[model samples]
Target: MKNDVKEFFDNSEHRPPKFGVLQGVKVVFSAIEVAGPLGPHFMAEWGADVIWLENVNGGDTNRNYRPSEHEHRNDRSMSLDIFSEDGMAVFKKLVKEADVFLVGGKGPSFIRKGITDEFLWAINPKLVITRISGYGQEDADPNYIDRPCYDGIAQAMSGYMSQNGTPESPMPAYPYVGDLFTAMFSLSSTLAALIRARETGKGESVDIAMTEVLMRLSTYNMVDYLNDGRMYPRPGAKDPIQGATGIYKTKNGFLFTNILGRKQMKTLFNMIGCEELYGVGDFKEGFSFINLNWDKADYVESKVEAYFKTKTNEEHIEIFDSMKVAAAPVLSFKDVVEHPQYKARDMWVDWDTMTTEEKYKGVNVVPRFKVNPTKIWRSMPHIGYDNDVILEDLGYSEEQINELYHKGVIFRNDRDK
Candidate 1:
């Protein structure tokens, strides 16, 4: 794997020397919320020049998500009202330079705001256009085309909520259901498009519906219903396929442990001082032995629960670690933030916010890179913070920039304030 990653960098023609992975790649984004912003955020983290275009007023809604001590939280955004001719002209210029364009939202107003895939493709034939929406790009139902959706709606409709949590404790999970998965798909498709564009000078359009992404993720349950003719209902606490594995309450908190086979079961029993169950009755036949009679599972789980209750969470973790048993203590957000593993991996990035003059921190990029080290250059920018510099770099004169700002086509918060 290391060799493959090394080869990928060594053979790449456009690899950046500083970042060593992505150097000159540019992305123009007019996306909002988690679905669209996340994909481009990954690109930006990996050294892509991401220009975020937003409305002249408040900018992307994600800016107001969870404000950190940092000035602009940790996102990068700029204010440019693409509805205006000047704004459209600036956006077109960016499209000509960008390798990818990510768009979100719906309605004719979106097109009027210059976010249409066709308009983007017209600017640059090689532009990889990734459009994210609620339902899908296609649905015979008239309301589906321009329908607005949030995470909760996607979760309920995709049956994700149905399968998640206990049967009695059916509730929505915190992290947005389809958003992260959709972002992953979007990022994967963008990378694939980049590869294609590199080789064939052709870029394709990628349409990702959050509902579809969620549906694909819920395939295991869907497959059971379709292929095996079995309706897979929610299994509370216990996994249906792996019966003996579950979250067990300890003295301190919850701990998860799984003993799949009879050998593993024996190991678990021995670790917990229940070695008597090894050769007793039909248990000697192992997992296949116990699986034959469903009644045996209850007997085994009762024994396992009895053992788990004897030790505190820390003691159980140590015992499991020493025994090479698959066990983990369920950690809360606070625990995770202070986890030793995350600290060792440098998974949290700290940045100083210009507004607060205090350091704000958050989770860094997913999947740490060894060779091309990822670093947070700065905190996410305030709305239109980089207008002058960006406009100046794009070859717009000071007077022209001021005129555009005054015309309400471009925005700079400092100037506005």
Candidate 2:
């Protein structure tokens, strides 16, 4: 495994030093787009020897996407016809040595391709197979089990979309939160399975459904209605269950505040010239100061809103800061990029990209580690960029590799070049 990692660095024209906790973990994944490829992307960053399998036909759906560069880094790309006999033979050989296998598409889709969890377990009993799908592998309703889905579909079906936005219109969170969350869950479950596999010498098949994972994430949104017949109103930019805890339009820009706790609420009310309102009705009850269920919520909210309209966001933020009320000026992307805290935290870094010589600036690796910190060794590769070296590592002779390429069992986008 050390030799393989060394070879990966030595073979590439431009490669950084590798440092991560998953140095010995070998992950082979055949997944496309966001939900599937993104999980292995993290493993690759963390020094797992990840081989991204793309069909010889056209490869992943993200083949032409620009944003895919960041997510596909630090991994080897292999274009193989996995449905063909020769391809399947190569795939099985890879699986035999792999610790984890991530398969995208529906369960039946893989079954028709002669790739099943049982078949894979037969090859390597300790293999953790993570199946990423729209719904799930098993369900009483075939329609749900086999439905074609993407990030938006999952968000819509999981009731996540309905919980967001204003009361009149619900919105799905942007930039594919559904897919991103599912990928994170997939990585987590796969790692858990890996621990169990090592402990008991038994591999486990994890069925990760996008909708199910999104629904799980929306647990807080559903519990109120599930336990009691009370449905919370969609608060848009407000904190759903708390008063004086939402975005307010100021004289300039917006201010967001979450005035919780009795002390904080008293401070906020006094700041807005509504201290009298804080001393009566439900406000007299136990810890009722920011409770949205208060009978005079509309009038109190109006007072707060009217007060905010008189001051600029920055001015209000300063007052809130002095008053010990949690508040912030609603910042745009421009503000965030130029933010002093953002710069001090070193939230962005620049690295070389595969598609060009220019450096790509992106968010740095999160949750910094003191030792074996993850690094981006290389940028995303073109289709089959590491075909020769990967196949060579698999013990195929140079001639045999060329033969596979000639047979259309293996493909490299740069082969002709």
Candidate 3:
């Protein structure tokens, strides 16, 4: 088992995979908030030179977030207080040399900061300027455009929250799914534009809206709503599948199951000794029967519940796995992080494994590649830690760097200087 697991990891491991898809590329991150930072985080993993062009006001503010110990690593930080002339000079220098510049904030306010798409384009015609916002790149009325929005706001506006929870009270989905999906879409779209820029010798400003991503993901629900006034809702919805689909409680823990195919339904019925339900097709007959008689739905649910209650979670898992039925335990974080299956699959890594002390936590990169995998090259920068390095790269002398530091145009960790 260990050898097989090792081979599986060796085939897909990120420890020195054939990365460098974005080699020789420079990305300047002029954005600070949550959604803005995410897409670029993945790009940095792809071997690009990502510089965090933070503001001296607070330096990206992500540092102040809870559990932000590892947030300050992996990238170089240079506090570009662009409000000042000297700072704007340094900011322009970075943008002039950058291939992709990520900018975020509200629509009008962010553009008014004097770093427009046109400005960056003229500086570096090949620069792909990417923008992310709650309402997109709007210059509309402040009432709508200037409103503060978060993950829940996107969920509510995009019709996701409406269908997520029970009918008693709709609950917001946790784990920041709304924010994350938006970032993912933005990443892929921006990569496409970056590709186009490389081919066309012209840059593009890609604008992404948070609510729009959620709206696109909620298309199926929109379909039924548009067809009729009724929406395909899941509030208090028991079965997601046609026949048997739900999280069932066993002797030990909860496990989710899906009876999708006719064979699976027949096998489940035989296993439960419910001969009457045998040979019921999942979509064709079982769905019709449940729809026709509410009592039948209740009856089937009760039988499934009873059958699950008779078995331990492990037993249920074993039986289902052996029969090729879909089943999985609803794992918590503690169960997941320590799981042998995930460890064997190389899903995550020990953060401080190579370090002297384990100060940082675990790290799991996103959108794993089969061939050209992404790699983590550096730690998150200390506040303005890359100030000297970036300044020197831009042809600034040590005296010039000291002048900017003394003027408070840049801030850094004391150890940085």
Model-by-model lDDT, in order? 0.69, 0.82, 0.70
Q: Per-residue alpha-carbon lDDT of model 1 for 299-402, expressed as tens digits?
A: 66676677777789999878777656678889998999899997876666655555456666666655656777444455566677767766776789999998
By TM-score, the candidates rank as 2, 3, 1
Clashes of 2: 0
Give model 2 RMSD, 1 decimal.
Answer: 3.5
Give the number of the best model, judged by lDDT: 2
**Each model's number of backbone clashes?**
0, 0, 5
Question: Which residue pairs in candidate 2 have backbone atoms (N, alpha carbon, C) closer than 3 angstroms, thus clashing?
Answer: none
Q: Which ten residues in a row have the lowest lDDT in candidate 3?
A: 3-12
Candidate 2 off by > 4 Å: 1-18, 285-289
Clashing pairs in 1: none
lDDT of 2 by residue, 1-417 (tens): 111222333325422345788888889999899999888888887878899999888888786877787788787899999888888889988999999999888655786667888999999999999999988876626767777889999999999988888999999898899999999999999999999998998999999999889889888869887888677788888878877888999999898987777667766677778777767877773363566788888778888889989999888878778767778888998899899998877777667765687877777666565567676677777788888877777789999999999999988887765
